[model samples]
Target: MNLKFYTFAKNIVKIVLSPAFRVKTIGKENFPKDGGVLICANHIENLDPPIVGITCPRDIHFMAKEEIFHLPVLKDILPRVNAFPVKRGMSDREALRTGLSLLKEGKVLGLFPEGTRSKSGELGEGLAGAGFFALRTEAKIVPCAIIGPYKLFRPLKVIYGNPIDFTEYRAKKISADEATKIIMDEIRALLSAGK
Candidate 1:
Protein backbone atom coordinates (compact mmCIF):
# COMPACT_ATOMS: atom_id res chain seq x y z
CA MET A 1 0.00 0.00 0.00
CA ASN A 2 1.09 3.56 -0.56
CA LEU A 3 2.68 5.22 2.48
CA LYS A 4 0.03 7.92 2.46
CA PHE A 5 -2.77 5.36 2.35
CA TYR A 6 -1.24 3.37 5.18
CA THR A 7 -1.01 6.49 7.32
CA PHE A 8 -4.60 7.37 6.54
CA ALA A 9 -5.80 3.88 7.45
CA LYS A 10 -3.77 3.87 10.65
CA ASN A 11 -5.27 7.17 11.71
CA ILE A 12 -8.77 5.97 11.07
CA VAL A 13 -8.23 2.83 13.10
CA LYS A 14 -6.70 4.80 15.95
CA ILE A 15 -9.54 7.30 15.98
CA VAL A 16 -12.08 4.51 16.09
CA LEU A 17 -10.46 2.03 18.45
CA SER A 18 -8.74 4.30 20.94
CA PRO A 19 -12.00 5.70 22.18
CA ALA A 20 -13.84 2.40 22.10
CA PHE A 21 -11.15 0.55 24.02
CA ARG A 22 -10.41 3.51 26.25
CA VAL A 23 -6.77 3.04 25.26
CA LYS A 24 -4.11 4.94 27.15
CA THR A 25 -0.39 5.00 26.38
CA ILE A 26 2.51 5.90 28.63
CA GLY A 27 6.19 6.56 27.81
CA LYS A 28 5.62 6.70 24.05
CA GLU A 29 8.48 9.17 23.67
CA ASN A 30 10.80 6.49 25.02
CA PHE A 31 10.89 5.22 21.44
CA PRO A 32 13.91 6.74 19.76
CA LYS A 33 13.63 8.55 16.45
CA ASP A 34 15.97 6.41 14.31
CA GLY A 35 17.69 3.07 13.78
CA GLY A 36 16.40 -0.48 13.52
CA VAL A 37 13.95 -0.44 16.44
CA LEU A 38 12.10 -3.37 17.98
CA ILE A 39 8.95 -3.01 20.03
CA CYS A 40 8.69 -6.14 22.17
CA ALA A 41 5.49 -6.70 24.07
CA ASN A 42 3.75 -9.65 25.69
CA HIS A 43 0.70 -10.64 23.68
CA ILE A 44 -2.58 -10.26 25.47
CA GLU A 45 -5.05 -9.83 22.62
CA ASN A 46 -5.27 -10.67 18.93
CA LEU A 47 -5.58 -6.95 18.32
CA ASP A 48 -2.29 -6.23 20.16
CA PRO A 49 -0.40 -5.44 16.97
CA PRO A 50 -2.69 -2.66 15.82
CA ILE A 51 -3.30 -1.63 19.42
CA VAL A 52 0.35 -0.81 19.84
CA GLY A 53 0.81 0.30 16.24
CA ILE A 54 -1.87 2.97 16.41
CA THR A 55 -0.12 4.96 19.13
CA CYS A 56 3.45 4.39 17.95
CA PRO A 57 5.47 7.36 16.76
CA ARG A 58 6.88 5.38 13.85
CA ASP A 59 5.37 2.89 11.46
CA ILE A 60 5.56 -0.69 12.82
CA HIS A 61 6.12 -3.64 10.53
CA PHE A 62 4.60 -6.39 12.72
CA MET A 63 5.48 -10.05 12.40
CA ALA A 64 2.10 -11.67 11.93
CA LYS A 65 1.30 -15.38 11.68
CA GLU A 66 1.80 -17.06 8.30
CA GLU A 67 -1.64 -18.62 8.59
CA ILE A 68 -3.25 -15.20 8.46
CA PHE A 69 -1.99 -14.70 4.92
CA HIS A 70 -3.75 -17.86 3.76
CA LEU A 71 -7.04 -16.24 4.63
CA PRO A 72 -8.66 -14.77 1.51
CA VAL A 73 -9.41 -11.43 3.05
CA LEU A 74 -6.37 -10.84 5.28
CA LYS A 75 -3.95 -12.14 2.64
CA ASP A 76 -4.49 -8.99 0.64
CA ILE A 77 -5.10 -6.63 3.56
CA LEU A 78 -2.31 -7.56 6.03
CA PRO A 79 0.69 -6.63 3.93
CA ARG A 80 -1.00 -3.41 3.01
CA VAL A 81 -1.38 -2.70 6.73
CA ASN A 82 2.35 -3.30 7.38
CA ALA A 83 1.98 -6.86 8.72
CA PHE A 84 4.30 -9.54 7.30
CA PRO A 85 3.78 -13.28 7.71
CA VAL A 86 5.91 -15.50 9.94
CA LYS A 87 5.49 -19.19 10.68
CA ARG A 88 4.84 -19.44 14.40
CA GLY A 89 7.04 -21.85 16.43
CA MET A 90 9.35 -22.60 13.50
CA SER A 91 12.67 -21.42 12.19
CA ASP A 92 11.34 -19.58 9.20
CA ARG A 93 14.33 -18.28 7.24
CA GLU A 94 12.16 -16.42 4.75
CA ALA A 95 10.49 -14.52 7.57
CA LEU A 96 13.86 -13.84 9.14
CA ARG A 97 15.16 -12.41 5.90
CA THR A 98 12.08 -10.23 5.55
CA GLY A 99 12.46 -8.96 9.12
CA LEU A 100 16.16 -8.20 8.66
CA SER A 101 15.51 -6.39 5.43
CA LEU A 102 12.92 -4.16 7.04
CA LEU A 103 15.20 -3.39 9.97
CA LYS A 104 18.05 -2.64 7.59
CA GLU A 105 15.87 0.15 6.29
CA GLY A 106 15.76 1.62 9.83
CA LYS A 107 12.11 0.78 10.43
CA VAL A 108 10.37 -0.25 13.66
CA LEU A 109 9.54 -3.94 13.93
CA GLY A 110 6.80 -5.04 16.36
CA LEU A 111 7.28 -8.44 17.96
CA PHE A 112 5.32 -10.31 20.61
CA PRO A 113 8.01 -12.39 22.20
CA GLU A 114 5.47 -14.47 24.07
CA GLY A 115 4.64 -15.99 20.66
CA THR A 116 0.89 -16.21 21.34
CA ARG A 117 -1.79 -14.40 23.24
CA SER A 118 -2.10 -14.91 26.99
CA LYS A 119 -5.89 -14.96 27.04
CA SER A 120 -5.88 -14.95 30.82
CA GLY A 121 -3.44 -12.02 30.76
CA GLU A 122 -0.66 -14.05 32.39
CA LEU A 123 2.60 -13.67 30.45
CA GLY A 124 4.33 -16.74 29.17
CA GLU A 125 7.98 -17.51 28.64
CA GLY A 126 9.22 -15.71 25.55
CA LEU A 127 10.28 -17.45 22.37
CA ALA A 128 13.87 -17.20 21.16
CA GLY A 129 13.04 -15.36 17.94
CA ALA A 130 13.00 -11.95 19.58
CA GLY A 131 16.45 -12.46 21.09
CA PHE A 132 17.75 -13.73 17.78
CA PHE A 133 16.48 -10.62 16.03
CA ALA A 134 18.06 -8.38 18.63
CA LEU A 135 21.35 -10.20 18.14
CA ARG A 136 21.18 -10.09 14.36
CA THR A 137 20.22 -6.46 13.90
CA GLU A 138 21.78 -5.01 17.06
CA ALA A 139 18.45 -3.25 17.34
CA LYS A 140 17.21 -1.58 20.48
CA ILE A 141 14.29 -3.46 22.01
CA VAL A 142 11.66 -1.33 23.69
CA PRO A 143 10.03 -3.36 26.46
CA CYS A 144 6.28 -2.76 26.36
CA ALA A 145 3.49 -3.58 28.79
CA ILE A 146 -0.11 -3.82 27.56
CA ILE A 147 -2.56 -4.13 30.40
CA GLY A 148 -6.33 -4.74 30.59
CA PRO A 149 -8.86 -6.63 28.52
CA TYR A 150 -10.34 -5.48 25.21
CA LYS A 151 -13.77 -4.47 26.42
CA LEU A 152 -16.02 -1.66 25.38
CA PHE A 153 -15.03 1.46 27.35
CA ARG A 154 -12.67 -0.47 29.62
CA PRO A 155 -9.32 1.29 29.85
CA LEU A 156 -6.50 -0.66 28.19
CA LYS A 157 -3.07 0.71 28.79
CA VAL A 158 0.14 0.30 26.75
CA ILE A 159 3.43 1.30 28.32
CA TYR A 160 6.69 1.71 26.41
CA GLY A 161 9.80 1.22 28.51
CA ASN A 162 13.34 2.33 27.78
CA PRO A 163 15.19 0.78 24.86
CA ILE A 164 17.41 -2.28 25.43
CA ASP A 165 20.57 -2.80 23.41
CA PHE A 166 22.20 -6.24 23.35
CA THR A 167 25.16 -5.09 21.31
CA GLU A 168 27.52 -6.58 23.88
CA TYR A 169 26.07 -10.02 23.25
CA ARG A 170 25.83 -9.70 19.45
CA ALA A 171 29.29 -11.06 18.66
CA LYS A 172 29.41 -13.27 21.72
CA LYS A 173 28.52 -16.95 21.85
CA ILE A 174 25.50 -16.35 24.05
CA SER A 175 22.86 -19.06 23.99
CA ALA A 176 19.34 -18.23 22.89
CA ASP A 177 18.11 -19.15 26.37
CA GLU A 178 20.41 -16.59 27.92
CA ALA A 179 19.38 -13.89 25.49
CA THR A 180 15.76 -14.72 26.09
CA LYS A 181 16.24 -14.47 29.84
CA ILE A 182 17.89 -11.08 29.50
CA ILE A 183 15.11 -9.79 27.30
CA MET A 184 12.31 -11.28 29.35
CA ASP A 185 13.62 -9.82 32.58
CA GLU A 186 13.25 -6.37 31.11
CA ILE A 187 9.79 -7.19 29.88
CA ARG A 188 8.77 -8.60 33.26
CA ALA A 189 9.88 -5.39 34.87
CA LEU A 190 7.74 -3.41 32.45
CA LEU A 191 4.74 -5.58 33.12
CA SER A 192 5.19 -5.33 36.84
CA ALA A 193 5.22 -1.55 36.58
CA GLY A 194 1.72 -1.47 35.20
CA LYS A 195 0.34 -3.24 38.29
Candidate 2:
Protein backbone atom coordinates (compact mmCIF):
# COMPACT_ATOMS: atom_id res chain seq x y z
CA MET A 1 0.00 0.00 0.00
CA ASN A 2 1.08 3.59 -0.57
CA LEU A 3 1.64 4.71 2.97
CA LYS A 4 2.52 8.26 2.02
CA PHE A 5 -0.47 8.64 -0.28
CA TYR A 6 -2.78 7.16 2.30
CA THR A 7 -1.63 9.61 4.94
CA PHE A 8 -1.91 12.55 2.57
CA ALA A 9 -5.38 11.55 1.45
CA LYS A 10 -6.53 11.02 5.00
CA ASN A 11 -5.35 14.48 6.01
CA ILE A 12 -7.08 16.08 3.06
CA VAL A 13 -10.30 14.26 3.88
CA LYS A 14 -10.11 15.36 7.49
CA ILE A 15 -9.73 18.97 6.48
CA VAL A 16 -12.51 18.79 3.92
CA LEU A 17 -14.92 17.13 6.30
CA SER A 18 -14.15 19.13 9.42
CA PRO A 19 -15.95 22.23 8.23
CA ALA A 20 -19.17 20.45 7.33
CA PHE A 21 -19.67 17.92 10.10
CA ARG A 22 -19.15 17.45 13.78
CA VAL A 23 -17.38 14.16 13.49
CA LYS A 24 -16.97 12.25 16.72
CA THR A 25 -15.47 8.86 17.47
CA ILE A 26 -16.05 6.60 20.44
CA GLY A 27 -14.49 3.40 21.74
CA LYS A 28 -11.30 3.84 19.74
CA GLU A 29 -9.58 2.21 22.67
CA ASN A 30 -11.33 -1.00 21.74
CA PHE A 31 -9.12 -1.52 18.73
CA PRO A 32 -6.54 -4.26 19.06
CA LYS A 33 -2.97 -3.00 19.28
CA ASP A 34 -1.59 -5.82 17.10
CA GLY A 35 -2.62 -8.78 14.95
CA GLY A 36 -5.27 -9.08 12.29
CA VAL A 37 -8.77 -7.75 12.97
CA LEU A 38 -11.99 -7.79 10.98
CA ILE A 39 -13.92 -4.53 11.17
CA CYS A 40 -17.60 -5.08 10.34
CA ALA A 41 -19.55 -1.88 9.96
CA ASN A 42 -23.12 -0.93 9.02
CA HIS A 43 -23.14 0.84 5.68
CA ILE A 44 -25.20 3.97 5.22
CA GLU A 45 -23.64 6.20 2.60
CA ASN A 46 -20.88 6.37 0.01
CA LEU A 47 -18.65 8.26 2.41
CA ASP A 48 -18.83 5.54 5.05
CA PRO A 49 -15.59 3.84 4.08
CA PRO A 50 -13.44 6.97 4.19
CA ILE A 51 -15.17 8.17 7.34
CA VAL A 52 -14.30 4.98 9.12
CA GLY A 53 -10.88 4.85 7.54
CA ILE A 54 -9.86 8.27 8.81
CA THR A 55 -11.32 7.79 12.28
CA CYS A 56 -9.71 4.42 12.77
CA PRO A 57 -6.28 4.55 14.39
CA ARG A 58 -4.95 1.63 12.37
CA ASP A 59 -4.63 1.61 8.62
CA ILE A 60 -7.64 -0.29 7.24
CA HIS A 61 -7.65 -2.17 3.98
CA PHE A 62 -11.26 -2.05 2.79
CA MET A 63 -13.14 -4.26 0.35
CA ALA A 64 -15.13 -1.86 -1.79
CA LYS A 65 -17.61 -2.78 -4.51
CA GLU A 66 -16.06 -3.58 -7.86
CA GLU A 67 -18.17 -1.01 -9.64
CA ILE A 68 -16.58 1.87 -7.72
CA PHE A 69 -13.18 0.73 -8.84
CA HIS A 70 -14.28 1.40 -12.39
CA LEU A 71 -14.87 5.08 -11.73
CA PRO A 72 -12.50 7.46 -13.49
CA VAL A 73 -10.24 9.01 -10.87
CA LEU A 74 -11.22 6.84 -7.90
CA LYS A 75 -10.17 3.78 -9.85
CA ASP A 76 -6.59 4.93 -9.67
CA ILE A 77 -6.70 6.45 -6.20
CA LEU A 78 -8.60 3.74 -4.30
CA PRO A 79 -6.06 1.00 -4.74
CA ARG A 80 -3.28 3.25 -3.52
CA VAL A 81 -5.19 3.95 -0.33
CA ASN A 82 -5.55 0.25 0.51
CA ALA A 83 -8.97 -0.15 -1.10
CA PHE A 84 -9.70 -3.23 -3.22
CA PRO A 85 -12.66 -4.29 -5.31
CA VAL A 86 -15.08 -7.09 -4.50
CA LYS A 87 -17.76 -8.24 -6.89
CA ARG A 88 -21.20 -7.87 -5.37
CA GLY A 89 -24.40 -9.95 -5.67
CA MET A 90 -22.35 -13.09 -6.37
CA SER A 91 -19.81 -15.33 -4.72
CA ASP A 92 -16.64 -13.45 -5.56
CA ARG A 93 -14.04 -16.00 -4.60
CA GLU A 94 -11.09 -13.85 -5.55
CA ALA A 95 -12.24 -11.07 -3.22
CA LEU A 96 -12.68 -13.58 -0.46
CA ARG A 97 -9.18 -14.90 -0.97
CA THR A 98 -7.74 -11.38 -0.87
CA GLY A 99 -9.53 -10.62 2.38
CA LEU A 100 -8.39 -13.85 3.99
CA SER A 101 -4.82 -13.33 2.85
CA LEU A 102 -4.75 -9.87 4.40
CA LEU A 103 -6.05 -11.18 7.71
CA LYS A 104 -3.59 -14.04 7.79
CA GLU A 105 -0.84 -11.52 7.25
CA GLY A 106 -2.00 -9.65 10.37
CA LYS A 107 -3.53 -6.75 8.45
CA VAL A 108 -6.77 -4.99 9.29
CA LEU A 109 -9.60 -5.66 6.83
CA GLY A 110 -12.67 -3.40 6.78
CA LEU A 111 -15.95 -4.70 5.42
CA PHE A 112 -19.54 -3.64 5.32
CA PRO A 113 -21.22 -6.88 6.26
CA GLU A 114 -24.52 -5.58 4.92
CA GLY A 115 -22.88 -5.78 1.47
CA THR A 116 -24.50 -2.53 0.35
CA ARG A 117 -25.55 0.81 1.71
CA SER A 118 -28.75 0.93 3.79
CA LYS A 119 -31.12 3.23 1.95
CA SER A 120 -33.23 3.74 5.03
CA GLY A 121 -30.19 4.63 7.12
CA GLU A 122 -30.77 1.59 9.30
CA LEU A 123 -28.63 -1.45 9.83
CA GLY A 124 -29.40 -4.21 7.36
CA GLU A 125 -28.89 -7.94 7.47
CA GLY A 126 -25.24 -8.97 7.24
CA LEU A 127 -23.75 -11.20 4.57
CA ALA A 128 -21.69 -14.30 5.41
CA GLY A 129 -18.38 -13.13 3.95
CA ALA A 130 -17.28 -11.30 7.07
CA GLY A 131 -18.16 -14.17 9.34
CA PHE A 132 -16.34 -16.63 7.11
CA PHE A 133 -13.16 -14.59 7.30
CA ALA A 134 -13.46 -14.23 11.04
CA LEU A 135 -14.04 -17.93 11.53
CA ARG A 136 -11.31 -19.02 9.18
CA THR A 137 -8.67 -16.88 10.80
CA GLU A 138 -10.23 -16.62 14.25
CA ALA A 139 -9.38 -12.92 14.02
CA LYS A 140 -10.87 -10.44 16.43
CA ILE A 141 -14.00 -8.82 15.00
CA VAL A 142 -14.66 -5.14 15.74
CA PRO A 143 -18.27 -4.08 15.24
CA CYS A 144 -18.61 -0.47 14.13
CA ALA A 145 -21.62 1.81 13.69
CA ILE A 146 -21.73 5.02 11.63
CA ILE A 147 -24.61 7.21 12.68
CA GLY A 148 -25.51 10.27 10.63
CA PRO A 149 -28.16 12.50 9.13
CA TYR A 150 -25.26 13.94 7.12
CA LYS A 151 -26.72 17.41 7.18
CA LEU A 152 -24.57 20.54 7.06
CA PHE A 153 -22.76 20.99 10.35
CA ARG A 154 -24.67 18.09 11.81
CA PRO A 155 -23.21 15.60 14.23
CA LEU A 156 -21.80 12.41 12.73
CA LYS A 157 -20.61 9.65 15.00
CA VAL A 158 -18.60 6.50 14.45
CA ILE A 159 -18.67 4.08 17.32
CA TYR A 160 -16.39 1.07 17.64
CA GLY A 161 -17.48 -1.64 20.01
CA ASN A 162 -15.38 -4.14 21.89
CA PRO A 163 -13.59 -6.74 19.80
CA ILE A 164 -15.34 -10.11 19.44
CA ASP A 165 -13.48 -13.38 19.84
CA PHE A 166 -14.59 -16.44 17.91
CA THR A 167 -12.35 -19.07 19.46
CA GLU A 168 -15.24 -21.19 20.73
CA TYR A 169 -17.22 -20.84 17.53
CA ARG A 170 -14.18 -21.79 15.52
CA ALA A 171 -13.74 -24.86 17.72
CA LYS A 172 -17.36 -25.91 17.28
CA LYS A 173 -17.21 -25.04 13.63
CA ILE A 174 -20.22 -22.79 13.51
CA SER A 175 -21.88 -21.90 10.25
CA ALA A 176 -20.98 -18.62 8.58
CA ASP A 177 -24.54 -17.33 8.87
CA GLU A 178 -24.56 -17.85 12.62
CA ALA A 179 -21.26 -16.10 12.98
CA THR A 180 -22.55 -13.20 10.89
CA LYS A 181 -25.53 -12.85 13.16
CA ILE A 182 -23.25 -12.55 16.16
CA ILE A 183 -21.25 -9.81 14.47
CA MET A 184 -24.38 -7.98 13.33
CA ASP A 185 -25.85 -8.14 16.78
CA GLU A 186 -22.87 -6.30 18.17
CA ILE A 187 -23.20 -3.68 15.46
CA ARG A 188 -26.86 -3.25 16.34
CA ALA A 189 -25.95 -2.67 19.95
CA LEU A 190 -23.42 -0.04 18.94
CA LEU A 191 -25.94 1.77 16.79
CA SER A 192 -28.43 1.71 19.59
CA ALA A 193 -25.89 3.23 21.95
CA GLY A 194 -24.79 5.80 19.42
CA LYS A 195 -28.33 7.08 19.15
Candidate 3:
Protein backbone atom coordinates (compact mmCIF):
# COMPACT_ATOMS: atom_id res chain seq x y z
CA MET A 1 0.00 0.00 0.00
CA ASN A 2 1.10 3.55 -0.64
CA LEU A 3 2.42 5.45 2.38
CA LYS A 4 -0.32 8.01 2.36
CA PHE A 5 -3.04 5.44 1.89
CA TYR A 6 -1.54 3.20 4.50
CA THR A 7 -1.44 6.04 7.03
CA PHE A 8 -4.99 6.95 6.11
CA ALA A 9 -6.08 3.40 6.64
CA LYS A 10 -4.14 3.30 9.85
CA ASN A 11 -6.03 6.36 11.01
CA ILE A 12 -9.30 4.69 10.25
CA VAL A 13 -8.27 1.66 12.18
CA LYS A 14 -7.41 3.85 15.12
CA ILE A 15 -10.76 5.56 14.99
CA VAL A 16 -12.85 2.44 14.69
CA LEU A 17 -10.92 -0.03 16.78
CA SER A 18 -9.34 2.18 19.41
CA PRO A 19 -12.51 3.41 21.06
CA ALA A 20 -13.37 -0.12 22.06
CA PHE A 21 -9.89 -0.38 23.51
CA ARG A 22 -10.09 2.81 25.60
CA VAL A 23 -6.71 3.89 24.27
CA LYS A 24 -5.49 7.04 25.94
CA THR A 25 -2.26 8.99 25.99
CA ILE A 26 -0.77 11.26 28.62
CA GLY A 27 2.08 13.75 28.18
CA LYS A 28 1.55 13.73 24.44
CA GLU A 29 2.51 17.41 24.33
CA ASN A 30 6.05 16.37 25.08
CA PHE A 31 6.42 14.93 21.60
CA PRO A 32 8.28 17.15 19.19
CA LYS A 33 6.25 17.92 16.10
CA ASP A 34 9.14 17.42 13.69
CA GLY A 35 12.48 16.04 14.80
CA GLY A 36 14.37 12.95 15.80
CA VAL A 37 12.88 11.10 18.76
CA LEU A 38 13.25 7.68 20.31
CA ILE A 39 10.04 6.25 21.82
CA CYS A 40 10.94 3.49 24.20
CA ALA A 41 7.86 1.58 25.36
CA ASN A 42 7.14 -1.55 27.32
CA HIS A 43 6.10 -4.68 25.41
CA ILE A 44 3.08 -6.45 26.78
CA GLU A 45 1.37 -7.77 23.66
CA ASN A 46 2.04 -8.11 19.96
CA LEU A 47 -0.50 -5.34 19.49
CA ASP A 48 1.70 -2.79 21.27
CA PRO A 49 3.52 -1.15 18.34
CA PRO A 50 0.56 -0.57 16.03
CA ILE A 51 -1.59 0.62 18.89
CA VAL A 52 0.96 3.22 19.92
CA GLY A 53 1.80 4.18 16.34
CA ILE A 54 -1.84 4.62 15.36
CA THR A 55 -2.56 6.99 18.22
CA CYS A 56 0.35 9.24 17.44
CA PRO A 57 -0.18 12.08 14.98
CA ARG A 58 3.27 11.57 13.52
CA ASP A 59 4.69 8.71 11.52
CA ILE A 60 6.99 6.45 13.52
CA HIS A 61 9.43 3.83 12.38
CA PHE A 62 9.39 0.71 14.49
CA MET A 63 12.07 -1.99 14.63
CA ALA A 64 10.44 -5.26 13.68
CA LYS A 65 11.91 -8.72 13.72
CA GLU A 66 13.43 -9.83 10.42
CA GLU A 67 10.99 -12.68 9.97
CA ILE A 68 8.02 -10.35 9.64
CA PHE A 69 9.63 -8.70 6.64
CA HIS A 70 9.42 -11.99 4.77
CA LEU A 71 5.63 -11.97 4.70
CA PRO A 72 4.44 -10.93 1.25
CA VAL A 73 1.83 -8.41 2.39
CA LEU A 74 4.00 -6.96 5.14
CA LYS A 75 6.91 -6.64 2.72
CA ASP A 76 5.01 -3.88 0.92
CA ILE A 77 3.50 -1.95 3.83
CA LEU A 78 5.87 -2.38 6.74
CA PRO A 79 8.92 -0.86 5.14
CA ARG A 80 7.00 2.18 4.02
CA VAL A 81 6.09 2.93 7.63
CA ASN A 82 9.85 2.93 8.30
CA ALA A 83 10.06 -0.58 9.70
CA PHE A 84 13.26 -2.58 9.23
CA PRO A 85 14.34 -6.02 10.33
CA VAL A 86 16.27 -6.69 13.50
CA LYS A 87 17.64 -10.19 13.90
CA ARG A 88 16.80 -11.18 17.48
CA GLY A 89 19.60 -12.31 19.75
CA MET A 90 22.15 -11.22 17.17
CA SER A 91 24.23 -8.17 16.47
CA ASP A 92 21.78 -6.89 13.85
CA ARG A 93 24.21 -4.19 12.80
CA GLU A 94 22.20 -3.34 9.72
CA ALA A 95 19.06 -2.76 11.76
CA LEU A 96 20.93 -0.46 14.11
CA ARG A 97 22.34 1.44 11.16
CA THR A 98 18.89 1.79 9.63
CA GLY A 99 17.42 3.03 12.93
CA LEU A 100 20.17 5.61 13.46
CA SER A 101 19.94 6.74 9.86
CA LEU A 102 16.22 7.32 10.29
CA LEU A 103 16.90 9.39 13.39
CA LYS A 104 19.47 11.39 11.47
CA GLU A 105 16.75 12.06 8.91
CA GLY A 106 14.57 13.59 11.64
CA LYS A 107 12.11 10.72 11.93
CA VAL A 108 10.74 9.02 15.03
CA LEU A 109 11.73 5.46 15.87
CA GLY A 110 9.60 3.32 18.20
CA LEU A 111 11.11 0.46 20.15
CA PHE A 112 10.04 -1.90 22.88
CA PRO A 113 12.82 -1.74 25.40
CA GLU A 114 12.01 -5.24 26.61
CA GLY A 115 12.92 -6.41 23.08
CA THR A 116 9.94 -8.78 22.96
CA ARG A 117 6.35 -8.95 24.14
CA SER A 118 5.74 -10.48 27.51
CA LYS A 119 3.11 -13.20 27.48
CA SER A 120 2.40 -12.67 31.17
CA GLY A 121 1.80 -8.95 30.70
CA GLU A 122 4.46 -8.15 33.27
CA LEU A 123 7.23 -5.70 32.62
CA GLY A 124 10.33 -7.30 31.17
CA GLU A 125 13.90 -6.18 31.52
CA GLY A 126 15.11 -3.72 28.93
CA LEU A 127 18.01 -4.56 26.66
CA ALA A 128 21.11 -2.44 26.13
CA GLY A 129 20.45 -1.92 22.43
CA ALA A 130 17.75 0.70 23.00
CA GLY A 131 20.00 2.62 25.37
CA PHE A 132 22.90 2.42 22.94
CA PHE A 133 20.88 3.87 20.11
CA ALA A 134 19.45 6.69 22.22
CA LEU A 135 22.90 7.52 23.53
CA ARG A 136 24.57 7.37 20.14
CA THR A 137 21.96 9.45 18.34
CA GLU A 138 21.31 11.84 21.21
CA ALA A 139 17.64 11.34 20.51
CA LYS A 140 15.07 12.35 23.11
CA ILE A 141 13.68 9.30 24.86
CA VAL A 142 9.91 9.36 25.28
CA PRO A 143 9.02 6.78 27.85
CA CYS A 144 5.67 5.10 27.20
CA ALA A 145 3.62 2.09 28.28
CA ILE A 146 0.72 0.04 26.90
CA ILE A 147 -1.60 -1.21 29.59
CA GLY A 148 -5.02 -2.93 29.84
CA PRO A 149 -6.23 -6.16 28.25
CA TYR A 150 -5.32 -7.41 24.74
CA LYS A 151 -7.97 -9.86 23.75
CA LEU A 152 -10.00 -9.17 20.59
CA PHE A 153 -11.53 -5.70 20.81
CA ARG A 154 -10.76 -5.55 24.47
CA PRO A 155 -10.24 -2.20 26.21
CA LEU A 156 -6.62 -1.11 26.11
CA LYS A 157 -4.82 1.97 27.31
CA VAL A 158 -1.60 3.51 25.99
CA ILE A 159 0.13 5.91 28.32
CA TYR A 160 2.88 8.21 27.09
CA GLY A 161 5.16 9.68 29.71
CA ASN A 162 7.22 12.83 29.57
CA PRO A 163 10.24 12.77 27.30
CA ILE A 164 13.42 12.38 29.30
CA ASP A 165 16.55 14.31 28.50
CA PHE A 166 19.01 11.64 27.49
CA THR A 167 21.35 14.31 26.17
CA GLU A 168 22.96 14.76 29.56
CA TYR A 169 23.58 11.07 29.98
CA ARG A 170 24.73 10.87 26.39
CA ALA A 171 27.07 13.76 27.02
CA LYS A 172 28.35 12.15 30.17
CA LYS A 173 29.33 9.11 28.14
CA ILE A 174 27.22 6.88 30.32
CA SER A 175 27.29 3.16 29.67
CA ALA A 176 24.45 1.60 27.71
CA ASP A 177 23.45 -0.53 30.70
CA GLU A 178 23.12 2.53 32.90
CA ALA A 179 21.03 4.32 30.30
CA THR A 180 18.83 1.26 29.93
CA LYS A 181 18.06 1.23 33.65
CA ILE A 182 17.23 4.92 33.66
CA ILE A 183 14.96 4.58 30.67
CA MET A 184 13.29 1.49 32.11
CA ASP A 185 12.63 3.33 35.35
CA GLU A 186 10.82 6.10 33.53
CA ILE A 187 8.68 3.62 31.66
CA ARG A 188 7.88 1.92 34.94
CA ALA A 189 6.86 5.25 36.43
CA LEU A 190 4.35 5.78 33.65
CA LEU A 191 2.92 2.31 34.12
CA SER A 192 2.69 2.91 37.81
CA ALA A 193 0.73 6.09 37.31
CA GLY A 194 -1.77 4.21 35.17
CA LYS A 195 -2.40 1.86 38.10
Considering every candidate listed, which one attains the maximal TM-score? 2
Those runs of model 1 whose alpha carbons end farther than 4 Å from true positions after fitting are: none
Candidate 2 all-Cα RMSD: 1.0
Q: How does each model score on lDDT? A: 0.86, 0.92, 0.83
Highest lDDT: give the candidate number: 2
Clashing residue pairs found in predicted model 2 = none
The lDDT-based order of candidates, best leading, equals 2, 1, 3
lDDT of 1 by residue, 106-179 (tens): 88899998888886788899888888778778678888888878899999999999998687787786877678
TM-score against truth, every candidate: 0.95, 0.97, 0.92
Q: State each candidate's clash count.
A: 0, 0, 1
| Candidate 3 backbone collisions, by pair | 21-156
- lDDT of model 1 at position 73: 83
Q: What is the lDDT of candidate 2?
A: 0.92
Model 2 / residue 3 / CA error / Å: 0.8
Which ranges of candidate 2 are over 4 A from the true structure?
Answer: none
